[model samples]
Target: MEKLKVDGVSVSFGDNEVLRDVSLTLMPGELVSILGVSGVGKTTLFNVISGLIRPSAGRVLLDGQDVTGSPGRISYMLQKDMLLPYRTIEDNCALPLLIRGESKRTAREAVREKLPEFGLQGVGRKWPAQLSGGMRQRAALLRTYLFSKDVALLDEPFSALDTLTKSSMHRWYLDIMDKIKLSTLFITHDMDEAILLSDRICLLTGRPGTISREIVITEPRPRDGDFALTEEFLEYKRLVKEELGA
Candidate 1:
């Protein structure tokens, strides 16, 4: 069964239409990337999917149930780390579970057990301000994933990092996602990043967004820097750029 479905969805902010009849399906364990240029409503679509905003029309289904206006089934990560500067890393990561009424001890235990897997083992006691940009992002991702949401909506989560760091984090994200097997919708303006991480790339047209093309990445998993240099990868990037008028 599809993990998440956006059916005939349309969204508007007053008279400014953002999404028009946008539809897509995310199967379980799939990593789908929505690639579009700036101002193309990619983040708006993420917001709609995560229930931060209600669509002007249509339904959002999660595990075959309509969650169009439902709350909290999806976890969202943004470009900014958005970590609470004053809270310890572990505390910040555990906030989601605490909000769900889990006891503090239970939440801490869960975060402690998962910290090493997220590469945050010994730094849980440190504040976000003390961590590097990449570490902050890792903590943010851990916080998002710790919620155990069925779907993760990531909006340009690594765009702020240096090219080298961004590339490394891409690999880390894929590794963690593979371990968790969660469905994900990632939005990015970078064609290379989209191609590198997506199981399928959904290219959106300019302005009011709609899927213009869907390209499947049939390559094997655990793709690395070498994969980026392949003829097929370059061809896909070229085609997507041409389609987007990049």
Candidate 2:
């Protein structure tokens, strides 16, 4: 089933065009990544799909319903973790539920039950300051998931972490995704990270960014550490590099 679709989406800032006729779709439970160079308007495409910015043209569809220019229909996680410093991690994760009129106790209890899954056991009551960057991201993702479980639009959610931590989080994220089964659309400049996490990758290229290539990573899910060093991985790197003119 097609969970989400962006058909011929275009966005512009006055006379400056950001994205032009970019289109992509997410099948139910599939994880797709957008790979692009800086200033290619990947975020603008994301903003259009998430309905934060109305597209200059085209349609945004969720489950066959036309939802263009609508917000609150999909979950969007920006580059930052954006967890409230004053709130406990549990409270932070529960904020989405709370905002939807859930009782504080119920929200916290719901969040508490999933703390271990968040890799946050014994840390839920702790402040955001007490946790590592990876943990903060996990919490933020949990909060995003709470907002909309159907689809998640993630923008470089792991870019801040060091290589080692990011690697671990990639594994954790894939595992969590299997259990939750949410369709995901993410944008990342890291070729390896994109190849590692995505089932397929859509390349956004040019001044008015368009999805120029959609590369399917035929490798099985939850790839091992050595997958990046394999011939298939190298081929993906080669193809992506060619697409980017890098």
Candidate 3:
């Protein structure tokens, strides 16, 4: 069964329509990228899917069950880390489990067991300010996964990082996702990042967002820096750029 099905979704703020007849599906263990310019309602779509906002129209189904307007089933990681300055790294990563009523000891244990996998071991006791930007983002991602949500909604999660850090984190994220077998909806404006990390790309038009085109990346899994330099990858980026009128 499909992991997620977004059917004829529409949203508007007051009289200004944002999304129009937007529909898509994500298969189990697949990573899908949604690419569009700023103000094209990409972030708004994330909000709707993550239950941060109600869609003006349409339904969202998760694992074939209707979860429209339900909060907490889908995990969302935003552009900013949103980490609490007072909380330790381990505590921050444990926030999701804590909210789910897990005991502190249990939550810390779970986070510690997975921290090394995410390159965050040995720094759990440090404050967010003590970690580098990439480390902080990794912790945020760990927190999102700790919630045990089947679907992850990433909204420009690496946009704030420098190019080098963003590239490194991209590889790390792909490895982590592979290990966890997550079904993801990643939103971004970077064509290279989208093509490098996604199983399929959904290109959206500006303003009232709609899927202008969809391209499947037929490359093998665990895409890395080498894949970014391939001719096929460059062609896909070109096609998406043309579709977006860039």
List candidate 3 stretches off by more than 4 Å: none
In model 2, which residue pairs have backbone atoms overlapping below 3 Å? none
TM-score of each: 0.97, 0.97, 0.97
Per-residue lDDT of model 3, residues 62-161, tens digit only: 8888888888888889889999999999999899988889999999999999889889989999999999999999999988888855678899999999
Which candidate's lDDT is highest?
2
lDDT scores of the candidates, listed in order: 0.89, 0.91, 0.90
Candidates, ranked, lDDT: 2, 3, 1
lDDT of 1 at 113: 92
Task: Looking at model 2, report the run of 10 residues with the lowest lDDT sum.
Answer: 71-80
Over 37-66, each residue of candidate 2 has an lDDT whose tens digit, in order, gives 998998888788878899989999999999
Global Cα lDDT for candidate 2? 0.91
In model 1, residue pairs whose N, Cα or C atoms come closer than 3 Å (at least 3 residues apart or on different chains), thus clashing, are none
lDDT score of residue 103 within candidate 1: 98
